[model samples]
Target: MSCPHVTAIAAYVKSFHPDWSPAAIKSSIMTTAMPMNNSNQVLKDFAYGAGHVDPLKAINPGLILDLSEDDYVNLLCDIGYETPTVRKISGDNSTCPSLSARSLLKDINYPSIIYQIQLMQPFVANFTRTVTNVGFANSTYKASVMKGSNININVVPQVLSFRSLGEKQSISVNIARGKFSEPTVISSPLIWTDGEHSMRIPIIIDVTQT
Candidate 1:
């Protein structure tokens, strides 16, 4: 039901931005999605990832986190895939680099963030993301985080200014575990707004004892 609807929306978005990559299209849909349900309650990531898709907003997402084929190859290599296996998967002579999967995962430029940590342990996770400007040139976006009480989240440089279309900006988010009573999943939204457009991405932290 939702799958077909989302697929149609993706197609609709792709029709408008023919040059956008699949990852860019996905980011557009996810970032522009509605965060609340009809009942006016906030949607959970486990149930409604990135909330409901909005086709009209998806057409112009303002900024998109785009990924290239090389990015996929790099991810595979970082995940410990053998050189031969990666080459076969990429259908090219792609080689593996000596990179850590943990580090690569944080920098993948995906529209969402998820981290798992031990319940009683001191935890700090950092992620870096880059977004490309697709909206108005000379626009400035401010970063804000809606975090849970059990963690502290910080975004560096807090502001992004794009001078021209296709310009790219990178930001780093650092999360540290705070006092908590028990193991739980903390859900937050890291949003970048330019007064006109709001780009939201979910940041999920899983705290487990085991």
Candidate 2:
């Protein structure tokens, strides 16, 4: 069901922006989706990944978290893929970074944030993401979070200013777990609005006993 719907939406977006990459199309659909259901309840990431896709809104997602072939190669490297495997998959002489320089998985410039932490421990997960401007040539966006209890989420440089089309900006999301007694899962959103456009991404935190 969702497969066909998302496929059609992807095609629709592609028809409009023929130069956009698959990652950009996916980002548009995810960021422009409705996070809440018909009953006005926020959807969980596990149940509804990125909520219901809004085809119209997706056509103009304001900002897109576009990724390149190199980004995917880096992601595989960050996930501990061996150099030979990565080269085979990428069909290039790409090499993995040193262990000390490898990036965290959550740092991938996707349209969502999901992190896990050990129960009863203090931890901070920092994610770095870059978004390309596709809306108004001159626009400013402000970041806000609909955070859950027992967690603190902060966005560095809460405001992003874009001077022209295709401009890109990088921001950091720092998530720290607060003191809590029981293991639980929390779902929230990090939203960026530029007066006309509202781009959102889910932030899920799982506090596990293991």
Candidate 3:
């Protein structure tokens, strides 16, 4: 015989609600999820031939944004970002990983620091702006690199690998009547092996530290 049905259980299930929000829930699971943490003791662990967690590694994970570029520029420098007149400080560990600028503006704009580099070589082939949140909504301040020159650049990493998270796809600019060319932003940790050189766009993450 089948067991008796529990009305209360059914009622509870019907009343149950979803936690947090859909956007937040989606954010928790994405291609760019931030690192999570455990106990504080995790950080104090010693490092040698060892598997030990550290104090810093044990703290709660915060939000983060990664910046990259093909050409050198101040695209990530001195840029400012805030919430509708309410300037919230960046995280406590704001850092500039590359030699380029140590910071990015909350708002992405034109003539980016990266674009400035194209100036060094007016004879560019094709200029592509793969990242650099330029022309995006202010709510999502982004950084971008601008390029202009006359030269051919059929190099490594192709035109497709800058960043997938940024809105408004990358664009290519032709100066010498469509000859010179290069991508605007390049994903960091990129390997430029074929007569190619990678320029690390400097950036300062976690502004709170500043």
Each prediction's whole-model lDDT (CA): 0.84, 0.86, 0.26
Give the lDDT of residue 102 in candidate 2: 67
**Candidate 2: stretches off by over 4 Å:** 38-43
Order of quality (lDDT): 2, 1, 3
lDDT of 3 by residue, 130-195 (tens): 332211133222223223322222322233332323344443433222312442322111111112
Q: Which ten residues in a row have the lowest lDDT in candidate 2?
A: 35-44
Candidate 1 per-residue lDDT over residues 1-210, each given as its tens digit: 998998899899999999988899999999999876524323347667888788999998899999977788888877778889998999988777665533376788899999878766787888999899999999999998874445789998799999999999888999987545567666878999999888998888877787
What local lDDT score does residue 105 receive in model 2, on the 0 to 100 scale?
A: 72
Stretches off by above 4 angstroms in model 3 are 1-91, 100-122, 130-167, 177-210
Candidate 2 has an lDDT of: 0.86
Candidate 1: where are CA atoms >4 Å away? Answer: 37-43, 100-103
Query: lDDT by residue for model 2 over 46-140, one digit each (tens)?
Result: 76688888999999989999888777877998777899999999998988878777666777789888887887688888899999999999999
Per-candidate RMSD vs. true structure? 2.5, 2.2, 21.9
Better of 1 and 3 by lDDT: 1
Clashing pairs in 1: none
